[model samples]
Target chain A: MTSSTTEPIKITSKEQAEWFLNQYDTFLFDCDGVLWLGTHLLPRTKEILNYLTELGKKLIFVTNNSTKSRLTYTKKFASFGINVTEDQIFTSGYASAVYVRDFLKLQPGKDKIWIFGEAGIGEELATMGFESLGGIDTRLDEPFDATTSPFLQNGLDDDVKCVIAGLDTKVNYHRLAITLQYLRKTESVHFVGTNVDSTFPQKGMILPGAGSMVESIATSSGRRPSYCGKPNANMLNTIISAKNLERSKCCMVGDRLNTDMKFGVEGKLGGTLLVLSGIETEERALEINEAYPRPKYYIDTLGDIFDLTH
Target chain B: MTSSTTEPIKITSKEQAEWFLNQYDTFLFDCDGVLWLGTHLLPRTKEILNYLTELGKKLIFVTNNSTKSRLTYTKKFASFGINVTEDQIFTSGYASAVYVRDFLKLQPGKDKIWIFGEAGIGEELATMGFESLGGIDTRLDEPFDATTSPFLQNGLDDDVKCVIAGLDTKVNYHRLAITLQYLRKTESVHFVGTNVDSTFPQKGMILPGAGSMVESIATSSGRRPSYCGKPNANMLNTIISAKNLERSKCCMVGDRLNTDMKFGVEGKLGGTLLVLSGIETEERALEINEAYPRPKYYIDTLGDIFDLTH
Candidate 1:
């Protein structure tokens, strides 16, 4: 049942950091739980990044949270004292837009878009040269607010060729109804979702995320959206191409077993590290092994990486 | 979109009835929605039966409703003025017992059971000459009461080998919790459910059925139950063997598309006629062509069978 050759290690001090050096050529770090949660940075996170840079290791910040764009995440990381460029950040939102652009091969100025997400997703679509029709405040001027309105009452015009879902704070019955209507009318309309996470941690409580909205639309439309995020090959391809890293030399590290561990397994990365700081509990790890891929190393914290010998 | 040829037939009442007599050699009828709903028989039901008998067609009553035994259904049919022998009726409950007996090949006196259904399912198991335990009364101590009493709570011991579900008025959280616990501990414990339907018509309102209970146990146990009903080959085999009818000559007539039409399609019967008097609507008939083995004919009502030939 054990899939790894590396023995489990326990960490105590900074001197053991040499053990993890040169283990991986390209390191993919998850943003939300690994480096920082919301506005606060985890302890020693900056020092670890500085150390990784000093060693000339390749680093890419991969995040499934598509609520914010790369620019937003870049600014947030800079605020936390981790200086990173926009090109170094990859969001599920960016992956989804790139997937749609390449898959459809939309002619310039010919593609019409309908989006149900925040500014982050809109920016990604715009960067890919796709026109976005809706955003956070795009529907505020209508007689009834389409953004917050019920699905049955909202008027989603037929011009919308693609319906993209990322994250929306005002996701309600009206938004769902309009989305469903557009989906039904245009059977060929491409349905794409940023991720399939049911909930995300916010202020110590779990809030409904993109997966819930995807479920509603999928059930009504009898169509499963093409998810572009960790565990999905599209996102992994985007990351590999962007980093110019060989699949055999890259490693994905995260706290969630399904997303993070799956990325390593599906992308054929060198290794996967499951940190116990968030999401995947010990009990969940056992159950997830029944279906999902297992991580190469299980550690109490990301700091435990220091205990491993390259 | 149309799959079948609409050969319009303007037939007299006599020719219409004769067309049915000539076309069908073996008539398999579903009990609940077609023949009688609960206690009341539909109009002209008796005449239809008399006419079919006079035409010398072999008849078999098949039902997925495992709430009642063949004897109970036979008795109910007799009260409705359609005389039928116990051998003429077939139930999924009885078929499930047969499946366990022949397929699993359990030794007659050695098997211990945990049942989660009504009297019919228990009686069927007993008739099959298998040792049975755990009926509605055995679990709840009182009929139709879901609340667990002290006396009933003690019966949920660890030794139970099988969990069978049909329809139990006393099905509740306490019984479900115990059953789930047993299922989890003894992963080898066989779990069987009558069907996966959520609601059934009762007193002019849709009442929760065995499907919800089956779903609860499935969610907790993380195992799909072995089903014995229409669309499942086990039930179809039982009916064909009981009546000694060639599978090719028999026609399964019912209202629902998934269950009734599925039997016709799977069994490769003479014809699958979808009567619009029950579960599936006219719009559904159009969509059904998208699935395998579409229905032979779509009629407004079962009574229209009397108008099939010119």
Candidate 2:
């Protein structure tokens, strides 16, 4: 655990590829880094996904991205010339809706959730016919007298039973203020964050992610959310129960160890693979093992593995 | 200390008030509760200040509110018929400017400070001819696409040597984004907060304060500001150097324990007074001592001691 893959067998030839390809029936892949960087899809990514599909492997795209819905993800994959179904895509946003609906049993009319994210979260929550408040165009951005002793004219609703925070660009102070107010009213309001990625990738730039935005409310409220994304094992429950896949026959493929690899190891999946197409590097991955458990396999990029499939 | 002050001297009798009033010549007062509760000036507040003035005691009003400048504060006192001069007032905003200009040595001509509060913080910094970018009227509140991967089209100014965050009502995501971009640059850029109050007093409701706003920036940048208000010794240095008084001859009087009482103890002032006119009560004060050092003196209210003088 304190070092990177200790002499990991690199899949160089078709014989070596057949070893792992035959062993696992289910493959969970982290998008963004392993498949594409920003909008530019990586070379051989579509081909590898097709190759995996040809073998009748159950493929699921596990993304930490809470800004886009599963339908948007499906359209995005289609634009990339790879037809991805909604069932095969498991975004953190969709999982968050699942957490609120089925897991917590928040019925359509009885309960409401206060969202602190963008359209992705709103779209997913809408799918379950759940009502939400405090996203964009909610007009929480109206300027008030920047006074210390503010007058109370606003009324509170008793129906809000959950406060969910995700990657929000329009996250203003009022969203945080209202979220804290809901949590302070009662202990029953469950707090859930989509994911806690410290920083997220954009086009040639990295910005502060959901974890950075969520810390204020967490600190102010003196309560931490039950995170429903990667680094938490609950995200895989949907796939595990749906496929009835054995732990020994599942493998996780991701570019980072903390979220992707950690998810697999913590969830008790069969194996883990680390690719160096995104944030982590070959040298940095060795140092990272000191903190998180080492991944089972390491490769330079997804492009490096397609040669073994031949 | 791990315990509260056991058997704190309660200033009930005239003899008790005469003791500390005769011993300490330097008196520091916290504004919110000791003098007035919200907009209502407490009974006998003006009489006590006038009485202290007749006794030749040097007095200064220290406030953690950053929404107003020292000039505005002097005007506020005048409106209350107190006739207090500008020199008798020191706000957290004024202290923040002093921190950057005098303490951190951020030169006006060469270096600039980025502000994330209101006009109050900007006015104080401007008094010293220090230019700061960002704050109210910055137009960061304007709507943009709440996208996950926002492209970086804006360039950063390298002249900003210090970033000061206060209780901003207009705080948006861009302010947090720009501040992090500045801090992420060089280690030379300093981060400063007016005060770290988690929540502050409003009319009927308590809202998220400066501490809540500053946290995301502090957490994201991984750099803490040189805080310039209560519980910090720097506020005392302003009074100590100006009045040429020893710490042992000074006393701090306020309604709150954490900010006011801790300010006195941490600054090594001669005495500390806690008034139950505001947040704390007899029962709560006793329990608070378990975590923080108890104040040396306790009274029902400052109005109680004014009766002793009468």
**RMSD of each candidate?**
10.7, 3.2
Model 2: share of real contacts kept: 0.50
Please give the TM-score that candidate 1 achieves against the real structure: 0.54
**Candidate 1 Cα lDDT to native:** 0.68
Per-model lDDT: 0.68, 0.80
Clashing pairs in 2: A149-B202, B4-B289
**Which pairs, if any, clash in model 1?**
A149-A174, A150-A174, A151-A173, A151-A174, A151-A177
Expressed as tens digits, the lDDT of each residue in B1-310 for candidate 2 is: 7334466678888999988699898889999888887778989889888898899999989999998998998888887898888888888888888878778988987788888898889998888898878777545656532243132244667788988998887777777777777787889889899987877766655677888778877877877888888877777787677667789988999877788888888788898888888788887666655445677888888877779967
| lDDT tens digits by residue: candidate 2, A69-173 | 999999999989998899888888888888898788899877988888888888899888988887664566555433321212455667888988888877776
Candidates 1 onward: DockQ, in order: 0.03, 0.50
Q: Per-residue lDDT of B83-120 in model 1, one digit per residue for the tens? A: 89998888878888877777766656677566777778
Best by DockQ: 2
All candidates' chain B TM-scores are 0.85, 0.93
For residue A303, model 1's alpha carbon misses the true position, in angstroms, by 3.9
- Residues forming the 10-long window of minimal summed lDDT in candidate 1 chain B: B1-10
